[model samples]
Target: MTKNILFIMFDQLRFDYLSCAGHPHLHTPNIDRIAERGVRFTRAYVQSPVCGASRMSTYTGRYASTHGAQYNGFPLRVGEMTLGDHLRPLGMDCWLIGKTHMRVDAEGMERLGLSPDSVIGARQAECGFDVWCRDDGLWAEGPDGFYDENRSPYNEYLKSRGYPGENPWADFANAAVEGGDIASGWFMTNANKPANIAEEDSETPWLTGEAIKFIEQAKGPWCAHLSYIKPHWPYIVPAPYHDMFGPNHVPAAVRHDSERDNPHPVYAAFMNNRIGRAFSREEVRQKVIPAYMGLIKQCDDQMGRLFDFLERNGRMQDTMIVITSDHGDYLGDHWLGEKDLFHEPSVKVPLIIYEPSPDADATRGTTCDALVESIDLPATFIEVAGGKVPDHIVEGRSLLPFLHGKTPENWRDYAISEYDYSTSPMAAELDVAPRDARLFMVTDQRWKFIHAEGGFRPMLFDLVSDPNEFDDLGDSADHADIIALMYDRLGKWGRRMSQRVTVSDEQINAARTGGKQVGILIGVFEPDEVPPAASSKYRGPVPTKEKD
Candidate 1:
């Protein structure tokens, strides 16, 4: 049994949603079991909030700035080595089973045995993932559209199957709860969801079936990546799961038409930074929280299936398993949904890695509060498989030290997370939500500073006292020195890691049509927002969307 790696991930899982962490309703047995068998890290973070950049960091072991894979459609700079490229020579078969959202334009094809122009951007080609399948695309679709190839994945997967106009609350309440999240005939959240999605018309069960086959047949010392998209959106889970978490413990979400206090716009302004819109607290709790948690339970069940397969095959002890997410869900926290803003629920995530061995002391079945970034995954897995990470290719350190019972106190004194809200202001797509130009921020254990120029005053939060970030301490004379120090830190770090966009001649021509500057002007920091706490080197954003 050579060291095989099973890297399993979901799209938008939240850190606080795990049952092991005390959400009595979550019931995530498999993941909890893995935690019991390995290391459950309480403070894992991702470099960026979106899929593309986050994947870049996970595969390359560097910040988006350092690796230059900052956004979707943005290719990694030529010759930038990824951990996969580093491991192939070591005789480890690095196989990707689903969704590697890397850009597979012409160049990406050569890496995956496809021609970019001829092939639609498939999941496998983009990120050098060997084997892949994209989970119901984009997480939203219309009624009877859950599997539709053309409609949004979210809409289709979430479209209700019960009688129309029925109270969603009552409909879910009628579902049965047996065996405490025990697998019935089905194992997902939305078993009752209508089939006939154009792409997955037959049944999603087939997808899982293929996965079982993949696990059974994979080669030795293999590194496999499985990307699950259930809990992402279109928040429709199968029947029982929809009602799984008794209403009492469901996490609260923002409500529609409820926002009254968010006066400031997109931390600054730019394209894609749609005008901020307001939603009420109750709306999120009623419509949003239920759907989101339903999806979580659904994915949780699927994860259980994956683990059950491992256990049945007796591979649980021989494999090094990791469970995490690209990023987290906003779930109406800070009056937002999706990952973009700089809120804790949006940036902070859960990271659990299990290497089933007894002598592997200090980490097995233990919890570590060390601050870690998603960028560290690639390097961590590379090491677990008994390979050395190349010096030039890693911006993240391996977690082997922590696993070996030697986590240094200052291993990571501070963690960094970056965001790029670079969309055109006059551009067609704008979030009808709060929009700001661009803002930068940095957070240590206690304070958070956000800098927005203009009437958008900088804000400082004493997280120790105000974890919700409800108050601004920027104007206080007491924290001026700390503010100045953070600004300098952001400057120096940004200078070292930020990447500039390099568009080809064709892309430049396309941009010229709008008479807008198509070239990406990657900068060290977003135009300073009045600063309280801030990340040093973040870039880009726009104005347009207005919060109601």
Candidate 2:
């Protein structure tokens, strides 16, 4: 049995950036080590592309629609079970050492009378984890006040280290050293400058140290969700890392002139987005991508430190390690800045699972091309903990069978991803209603279908031929049949049984035997319709009644 889990999530890291995943310039050997020891899922996807909704789906093992956290800053409704809720009952302590990006459902908390200080309340507020240290990692302050309500512990640590500023989060941790002044790394032009903070004190390293501390203090079988907030935004890196990559390291943007010519309305709106327009320029890409690469490198280095620590401490043999990102960044691909689309750059993520078991040794260093999703991790963890996966609760299937070199029968054929852009500025620009602003992506190996609500036609991509997703095949007359088939699949996916929480499968199976006795056979008009074995039992059931 797996004694511990180190679930590592990198925010906004692209699937292809790592050298293990085939990036020509940028290398991520530390992350690649996890892949070398286990299975790397080449086609894993998340339910949503945005931070909050994506992580919510990951934690709850449910889709964004089922969890009701459809976008960033949206609350995961109270009473929804999460990974912590599932693992704790199996005697594993679920603890968080970094970001969750969870927005607590304060209204639901108030209505349900949950106090923030109580154990249950704390778990609800933090998405079911016992937080060792909670930091969403963004601490921007404006006239309206801080972007987040909670004060950043990293900011306090920066202030203590003699970094001077009203916002050390921006000035020291994210700013670059100039001759006499601080160059804010938030600016695209200043991306080449090294952040003033020491590399050891940067976000990635600091989180790693905290994770180590948590491991040292851990008493029993536990899972530490060590989420790192890097390669995400601010697009800057501290010393050494900042100087590591330059314009030469940046890859050419995967875009074409044909993508913009007669683009879909929603796609056009994304192109017009401020961040997308900024990233479209070659100069901007040259400046921004290098720092993004550097940040990823720093994260990899931290992983090296983390893994070495685990191994040196003898925890590696007993722990199962998972390395993945919540979702991929567009990096100006698909004419989009951030993730909010069905394109592979935005939705497809890297999923590597390393189980320290003899059974998993055969599949070591292998790649699994099967369709997988981020929500599947919860079930995988549950199984690794030697607990049965509650299928009715978790919508995803476990990868244990695959990890043991056994291919499951009737595995998923297509991957599903969703985006609710109603709260985004692009939705307003496109004049879409909040209720109607929804998009669902259903992708098989050869085809990708994007269905949008609010009077928009479906978008189709023949991934085998048009893998770059540059063509707007939504209007192609010849591919209408493929579009219809994909729609049928989406309908089937949408109609799956969800939220069967109150009733257990065992109870339902038991109820099956009560069919005729409870008058449930009312529709049986003919004796032949019933099975011969059950016909006599039901037919003579009303022969006598107990008179008391």
Best by lDDT: 2
Clash count, predicted structure 2: 0
Candidate 1: what lDDT? 0.60
Q: RMSD of candidate 1 to the true fold?
A: 16.0
The global C-alpha lDDT for each of the candidates, from Candidate 1 onward, is: 0.60, 0.88
Q: Which stretches of candidate 1 lie over 4 Å from their true place?
A: 107-124, 132-136, 139-207, 253-264, 267-281, 408-410, 424-441, 451-457, 497-548
Q: lDDT per residue, candidate 2, 27-101, as tens digits?
A: 888889989999999999999988888999999999889888998888899999999999998999999988999
**Per-residue lDDT of model 1, residues 361-451, tens digit only:** 5567788887787878887777777777653457677876777667755575667766555543422233432234344666777766666
What's the C-alpha lDDT at position 194 in model 1?
A: 23
Q: Which regions of candidate 2 fall more than 4 Å away from where they truly are?
A: 514-548
Clashing pairs in 2: none
Question: Model 2 — TM-score against the truth?
Answer: 0.93
Query: How well does model 2 score by local distance difference test?
Result: 0.88
